[model samples]
Structure formats: structure tokens, C-alpha cells
Target: MSGGRSAQAAIAIILAGGRGSRLGGRDKAAITLGGERLVDRAVSAARDGGALAVIVAGPAAAVPPGCIGVREEPAYGGPLAALAAALERPEAATATETLLLSCDLVDPAAVVGRLSGARWPAGADALVLRDPDGREQWLAGRYRLAPLREGVTALGAVSGLPIRQALSGLRIAWLDTAADDVADIDTPEDLDRARARSELGAD
Candidate 1:
């Protein structure tokens, strides 16, 4: 979907500033898989999915050209705070929908494609991916901008707030998908596995 009309109405917010405690505090965004940085992969996925604007909520230095970079107050404030910070940007205010993604995905393009192609259910505030094991991948979803903003507003001072708590009242639609589509790199072993999968040309 190369900037399709429907996708042009949506903006993407990538959460890339997490402190990778499991990986000895390394910068997850900078980590490479398939010879490309994770953050770069995320940017490519967002663009490929036809997002009108791509915003990376992380260190300004990690931000790639053609994408806006924002950081949550005090840094590492948590995903909800990152979302709040991104929503404050002008691009987000004008978007009809929001595509949220994290930088650690092993195959972000797969999830992005699914989200970009799926029909938004009437009356649903968000559409999230449900793994084969039935776990919701909150960040791998599409959200209606109005309800998402309202949810953020309802939770004043989102710093350090749990994402589920901030978005508790919204109506959610789930899309079931295979486990590999939702894989993320959190530890060294995970990174190794991603590299191995990449070598095998698995998506």
C-alpha cells in the first residue's frame, strides 16, 4: 500500500525509546536485524503502510530523516506517556486514525500490512492484534484519533501510566494473527532468533 488514499488519513506513532533492561540497557532502536536498524524497519513499515505522517517517539538522534521525533517528559516515562507526547504533535491532531507500533518488532511490516488492510469496525475505538496464544498486542494496532485522544485526556499526567489503564474504557476490536507476526526482540536470544529468521528469509 504505497500511500493509498485511505491510509493517507492515518498517522503512525512508533515507540522506540524503551530502556532495554533485558538486553543490558542497550538501545533497542539501534539494534539491527536483517542488516537494518529496528527503528528504520519500523519507519519503513509505517511508510509502506501509507501513513500520512510518521512520528518516532524516541531520542531525536535516533529519528530518521522525513520522520518527526519526540520524547516523553523525563524520558522512559512509559508507552502511554510516549503516546501522549506524540498526540501533542500537529500531525496527530489532523489524522483521522492512528497507527501505533513499537521499534522492537521482528516483522513490523507484516503487522502493519494487516492493520492497513483491515476494515475498521463501526463503533470500535481501536483495532488490536491478538496473537495465536490470545494475547493482545496493544501497540500493534490502529486507533480512531478522537477516542484515542479522549483516552489520553482522561488520564491526566500519563507519565509512568500503564497503557491498559489509560485506554481501559475504549471499545477494542481484535484481529487474530500468528505468533511470528507479533515477535519482538527483548533479549539477546530473541535478537539471535530474529537474525536467524532473517537469514532464512522468513517474514
Candidate 2:
């Protein structure tokens, strides 16, 4: 992968430790939408986006080759804990920023491109996407590594910590996208929608 200013200094951290209770206990990382496993798609997106390193915060079984796999201290400790675990890795130490993503995203590559190519504002600690309903998709954001590490440190115990609380003090820059590029699989119905979108070449 060729590196650029934004992507070259970044580390992609993929959160894949969800319990998937709504998907009949299926592993979201292994789930396929349009014949591609979600975790594999995430890794491809990170590499294609030119991230210096890729880290999958999930079970070893879900981690693909050429990527680092790490588990949160308490398995299934939620996204914040997964992110905290990723930040502790040696790979993250040299990165200036982080591409925080979830393994369930239907179009991870598109989202990664959007974030990596966008003009990050000066003094902002993060650049996050806002879905159609105006809800912030925290996991679909790019964050300054220093601030993220500081935030995790301040939280002390990251397990079970709410994501919003964990990143409470960061200055954010929001990107509003009209498409469902940030849609993620959480249920059978969601999976069906993602498949339909994929087949339609919407992604």
C-alpha cells in the first residue's frame, strides 16, 4: 500500500469483539456480506487506505494473516476496551493518528478512503462521521493517537466503559455523508440489507 500524509502516519484499529447477540450469537467478524468476511474487508480497507499498521482487536481466530490480533483484557469488554487494548500495542506507539473501525461495516474501504482523503482541520483531535440520522459513528472515525491514548489512560479501567465517556473531551470535526456507507451488520435483517446493497454495487 502506498502511503500519504494522513494514512502513512495512521494505525488502523479494527474492533471485532462484539458478542453479536442480535445475530444469533454469530461472529460478526466471520460473517459474510456478498461473499467476503467482514474482518477481511476491514483489513483490506486498512491496507488499501495506506495505514502504516493494522491491528485487529478480537479473537485470534478472527484475525487475518499480516495483521496483529489482540483481545481486550476482559473478552467482549466493548468497543472502548477493544480500542484501549489496541492503543497499548507497540505498533500504535509510532502512529500520529488512528483509523478506528468496526469489523461489521458493510463498506469499510469506502469509509476509510473518505476519512483518509478528507482535509483534517487544525487543532481537532478527531474526525468522525455522522450518519443520515445525525448520530455520530464513533467507531468510523479517525483520531489523534496522543489524545486517544491520553483518554484511555484517564479512564483507568476501560472494560465496560461507554465509548462516549471514554472519548468525552476530544475536539471533533464531523463529516456528514448522505449515503449508508457506514452501515454495519448487527442483525439478520441488517445482514440482508448489506447483501442487497453489495449486490447492487452500492458500496
Candidate 3:
């Protein structure tokens, strides 16, 4: 991990350990898109977007290549708890900002692009991308680490703290993206649709 460099934009982390009951219980980050692993897509996009360090937060089952592995600290708790755990990652100490990955998006690079061009205002606690389709996706977002830690601690469990709540005392930026961009790989139907779309060159 490098710090004090003008090029170091933020510390990026991918939340990949979700037990994907969708997509036939397959690991979403490991899912392939355009012949490249989804997690790899995320890493590449994040690095290209200026991440100084990249971390993968997920289960021990199978991890994608080219990232520092991170698991939820509370083991099986929700995202907030999982992030708190990830924040404690040895490599996380140098991260100025942290990114939460949905692990199953069709366009990770687009997601990163949406976030990179956003205006993270002063007092802006965190920024969550609004998937124009209406889902408030936690992944594909930018976070101000310091305030997140405070809110998570004050709110008790990490899962208990909502992104809104953390930004309650601060400003938040929303980067709108296409529905297909944030569409997750959940269920065989979704997977099939993804494959079908891939064949059709849609998305």
C-alpha cells in the first residue's frame, strides 16, 4: 500500500463474501463477465479509478485473484458489521476512503466511473450510488471512513447503521447509473438473463 502520493485516491474494498442464494448459490464475485472474473473486473476498474490499495471482503470458500482478502469480523453479521470487520484489516489502516462492492454487478467499471465523477462535498459522510432502477445499492458506492466508523460505533452493530444515518450529520452525493449497471446476479433467471444479454451485447 502506498500513501502520501498524489496518485493515491482512496482505499477500495470489495464486499464479496455474501452467500449468494441467487445465481444457484454461486459466489458472485467469482462470476465471469466478458471472460474475466467479476472481482477482477472490480479490481481493475478501481485501480484505474485511482485506488491505492484494493481489498476483497468475502468468505473463505474461494477468493478472486489480485486483492487482499478480508472477512466479516463478526463472522455472519450484516454489511455494517462486515465493514467494521473489514476496516480492521491490516491493510485497511492506510485507506483514506473505502468502497463497498456489490460483487455481482454487470458493469463494475461503469459503477466506478459513476463514483469517481461524483462531488463528495464537505461534511459528506458517505455516498451511495442510486441505481436509476430504484434499488439503493450499498455496493458501488463511496464512503468517508472516519464518519462511518463513528456512526457504526455509535449505532452499535454495523448492520444497524444505515448509510442514510451515517450521512445524517453530513452531506451525501448520489451517482445515478443505469439499471443494468447495478443489476445483481441473483437467481438462475438473472444469470440466464445476464448470459442472454451478453450474447445480445446488451448492457
Q: What is the C-alpha local distance difference test score of candidate 3? A: 0.69
| Weakest 10 consecutive residues of candidate 1 by summed lDDT | 1-10
How would you order the candidates by TM-score, starting with the best?
1, 2, 3
- The candidate 3 region of ten consecutive residues with least summed lDDT is 1-10
Tell me the spans in candidate 2 whose CA falls farther than 4 Å from its real position: 1-6
Q: Candidate 3 residues 1-203, lDDT tens each?
A: 12222335477877776667655667777788778777787888888778777777777543555667777656545556667777787666665677667667777777777777676665666677777666677777777777766765676656545544544554566666778877767787887787787778845
Best by lDDT: 1
Q: Quote model 2's TM-score.
A: 0.94
1 versus 3: better lDDT goes to: 1
Q: Tens-digit lDDT track for model 1 on 1-203?
A: 32233666788999998999999999999998888999999999988888879999999877999999999997999999999999999999888888899999999999999888888677788889999999889889888889999999897988888898866688999999999999999999999999999999945
lDDT of each: 0.89, 0.87, 0.69
Over the stretch 58-99, how does candidate 2's per-residue lDDT look in tens digits? 999899998999999889999998998898899899888888
Could you tell me the TM-score of candidate 3? 0.82
RMSD per candidate (Å) reads 2.0, 2.0, 3.6
For lDDT, candidate 1 versus 2, the one ahead is: 1
